[model samples]
Target: MRGTVWVASDIHLGEAVPQTARAFYDFLGRARREAGTLILCGDLFDAWIGDDHALRRPPRWLATALDELRATAGALPLWLARGNRDFLMGRALADALGARLLEAPAVLDTDAGPILLAHGDEFCTDDLAYQRFRRIVHTPWIQRIFLALPLGARRAIAARARARSRQARRSKPMAIMDVNPAAVAQALRAAGCDTLIHGHTHRPAVHALELDGRAARRYVLPDWEFDHDAPPRGGWIEIDAAGIRLEQL
Candidate 1:
């Protein structure tokens, strides 16, 4: 996907956040009308135990979100990327939604220029525990075992994991949770790209950095939360010939 590219992530759509889902649906409508290609960077769902569970028996909320995504895909190129929570998303989910699965750390040759894209959690090298947990859960055998379980069992397990994660975050230092500078620099160098765009830290901003005696920019995407928060928040990054810009909901 090139030309005018629109990227968003960390929407975390689920049963609880109807307002957020609605806001995202609206954004999809806008993207269909405006964007040349749309890329959902990651975490489009709060949790995705398995694609079978969602496709076989989608609740009202999931159905609506899927429909919205399908509608958007029908209008333009729609790409989905796996996030930390929705790492289980597979080709089946993308096919069902009429979208294509996008590989993380992908380099896009866009109108603005070539830019590296990622989900961003992999860059949080400061959090040793989370990185260790990430390694365990990402094991192929472990994931297959988890997905083979019953949907209800998977739901219970996911609930417990989420609870534990929230509790753990309460005790962890804030800096540890964000991406490490060294990791970011390494990723940019490895990818041979000067511009990096990602979501997961929920700290949306364009950071200026020096890499190999040259300028580099990292764009962090914001997470969406509209139901309980005092200020409803959501946004996306737009890349075009003009420049890269952030738009808010």
Candidate 2:
């Protein structure tokens, strides 16, 4: 990007979290004025059962969120990637907001340099149960079957899955939930990039790694939270000719 590129992920916007929605709207406005390109890495919505839900008969909260996204997209370049929670997001949603759909583990040639971007969940290879669940849900045929269901049914199924996922996380070991070192190494090598950017573990930090006799770095994007937290915690990565830096929102 010419001016500046801004990246963010895991907003998890939903009807239940009005404060988060508003905060995101504010962020969009700021981005329009400050950045030339804005990329939402993933999980922009808390639950995206299907694109049809928002395109056909969107609830009030969804409608408002769409409006904000549309405005931001109109003002600047917007690229969205699929997160675990909102992987159902498709071209229909992207078309509606004038945004481009980004594939996971995409490489971006930015002003700073080439960077690898992803939603981050795929690196948690240690979580066998989650990996199995991901395989099932991500299968093309299974996704088609799920999408063919009635919208109400899909919503119910998604809600149930979310509940079960929460329960499972409670009993799982913390280490399993985080990214596996081997998985990260494999991904970076496959992409042929030294820098990796993603969001899913929600634990935001920068890690320096030695890979294939070369130095590499991984940047974890923060998950946005405004309702449950006391002071509201959120941030984004800003990239320019100088370098990339995380800025608090």
What C-alpha lDDT do the candidate models reach, one value each? 0.93, 0.91
Tens digits of per-residue lDDT for model 1, 76-154: 9999999999999999989988899998989998888889999999999999999999999999999999999999999
For each candidate in turn, the TM-score is: 0.98, 0.97
The candidate that wins on lDDT is 1
Candidate 1 backbone collisions, by pair:
none
Pairs that collide in candidate 2 are: none
- Deviation of model 1 at 114, angstroms: 1.0
**Cα deviation of 169, candidate 2, in Å:** 0.9
Best by TM-score: 1
Regions more than 4 Å wrong, model 2: none
